[model samples]
Target: MERIVVVGAGQAAGWAVSTLRQEGFTGEIHVVSDENQIFYERPPLSKQVLSKEATYDSLNLFSPEQIDAFSIHLHKPDRATQIDRVSQQVTLESGKVLAYDKLLIATGSRARVPANTWKDIPNVVTLRDVQDCERLAKRLDTAQSVAIVGGGWIGLEIAATARKQGKTVDVFEYAERLCAR
Candidate 1:
């Protein structure tokens, strides 16, 4: 039987798995992710999640029942430390190795945190995943003002949510114009 492994169980990975099954690929489908929560849309993290308009559960791309129905092997809270091309194997942080006839890497992007002391600050937050959004949401609840470093889509989204929450928001962008490419 053919075996396929997907690194990262985010939105893209979820879709890829679903599409594969839909297209009649009958084989072992394995997904490895560092996050406990899998198959969630990131767009709502800044909007609905931050504003308390949407629950955390609402961000899931596929339900637990749906995942089980798809027969997808989801290894949660697990990180793939190495990929040996010669052996066609993926080694996880937990020391388990998954042999894959095909490998798909959809790890997605992260918040580009600058090398600074900001990471040490408790109040300073970055939005990349659900946990980050949750922390920022809690902080925004009591914050009188919000200082956002980036003017990208994520930053602007957070800024918009903060404004709706009646907080003073200042957005600092690297380029002269906001969201400059």
Candidate 2:
């Protein structure tokens, strides 16, 4: 059977797997994710999840039962270290290797906070994942004022959420306007 391996367990990766099945590719399917959580909605991380409007349990794109029913093998909390193009094998951090007839790389982008920024501070945080939002929400409870470094979508979204929580937010942008491209 044709074996398909997808590296990264984000929304795109989940969608690709579903699409492959919908397209009638009845081969072995494997999904690898560095995160322990299953594929969940990312947009909510900055909005509902960050604001405590939704919990991690409710943000899941697919439940464990559904994954099992669909026969989609999940390798959570595992990172892909390297890819052997010639041998068609993917090496993981746990010393496990998966060979694939078709491979998909659906790794999502991370929050691009500069290394020199105030990221090292205790209360300062970024809204990227569920854990990040949960931590930031907890910090917002104690933070009187929040200084957001970026003026991008995520920064602005978090700023709005923080503002709703009654915290004063200051957005720091190197460029003239917000989200300057």
Candidate 3:
């Protein structure tokens, strides 16, 4: 059987697995993710997820039962350290080596926090994951006024959610207009 390994556990990765199954490719499928949490919807992380309008359980893209049904082997909280394309081997941080006939690299992007920034300051946050949203939501409860540094979609979404929660929000955009990049 073909051995397939998918790096990164996100919406796209999940879809790829489903597509493979639909195509009737019966192979060994392995999914590796650095996140310990199960796959969940990303859009709601900055909106409903953070606002308590949605729960983590409700945001899951696939349930444990689904994973079992599909026979997907999930390696959580594990990061891929190196890839030997010539040999078709992937070295993980956990010292596990995965050999694959076909590989998919779906490593997602990270949040861009400015260098020399005052991230240590209280009530300052950037939303990227479920944990981030949860932490930001807690901060919002105690913050009367919040100065959001970006006017991008995430910042704007958080601003809207914060407003709905009755917190005064001031969005700071370095560009001429909001999200004018």
Question: After superposition, which runs of candidate 3 have C-alpha atoms over 4 Å from their true positions?
Answer: 116-123
Better model by TM-score, 1 or 2? 1
Residue-wise lDDT of candidate 2 within 4-66, one digit each (tens)?
999988788877877887788889998999888867778888877888788888878877776
Give lDDT tens digits, candidate 3, residues 1-181. 8899999988788888888888898999999998877556678888888788888788778878876777888888899999999999999999999999999998766776666466776656878777787888899888888888889888888999889989998988888888676
In order of TM-score, best first, we have: 1, 2, 3
**Model 1 lDDT per residue over 12-119, tens place:** 999999899899999999999999898889898888888889998998988888888789887878999999999999999999999999999999987777767878
**Maximum-TM-score candidate:** 1
Q: Which candidate has the highest lDDT of all?
A: 1
Candidate-wise lDDT, in order: 0.90, 0.84, 0.84
Model 3: worst 10 consecutive residues (lDDT sum) = 114-123
Backbone clashes (count) for model 1: 0
Q: Give the Cα error of residue 65 in candidate 3, in Å.
A: 2.1
Structure candidate 1, residue pairs in collision? none
